[model samples]
Target: MSVIPAELDGAVIPGGCADCNAEQHFRQDEPGMWFIGIAHDDWCPTWRRIQAQRAGLPTTFLS
Candidate 1:
């Protein structure tokens, strides 16, 4: 599951192991709509609130 709201406007689609949190892109090519996952890069899946006492980022509503 995603920690941030799925509606995040500026956030490009992410990829890789759910724990890896690496953001990747799906290029339009011979593979059709298949997504290529990136690893060891800039991924921010830390925003998720793990428990009650902990806090999560405010949900961002997109237009």
Candidate 2:
């Protein structure tokens, strides 16, 4: 269960983690991990798995 930290409420960074600073997340192995006082899910794992499972289907794209 990942919840946005109170300190990062309303924080915004283009191309970076929506919940934390982008510069802090440097580990390539877990690119989806965001540095918000801890390794938080910038992109939720369940959603990532779902996206992976649906990969290569034309419906995955949007018009």
**Candidate 2: what lDDT?**
0.44
Predicted candidate 1 versus true structure: per-residue lDDT over 1-63, tens digit per residue: 533343442345656546666665444333233334354333435423233225544456323
TM-score of each: 0.27, 0.22
Give each model's whole-structure lDDT: 0.44, 0.44
| Candidate 2 structure quality by residue, lDDT tens digits, 1-63 | 335444443344333335543332222223334443234355756445556777855765756
Judging by TM-score against the true structure, name the best candidate.
1
- Model 1 regions more than 4 Å off: 1-11, 30-35, 42-63
Q: Determine which window of 10 residues in candidate 1 has minimal summed lDDT.
A: 44-53
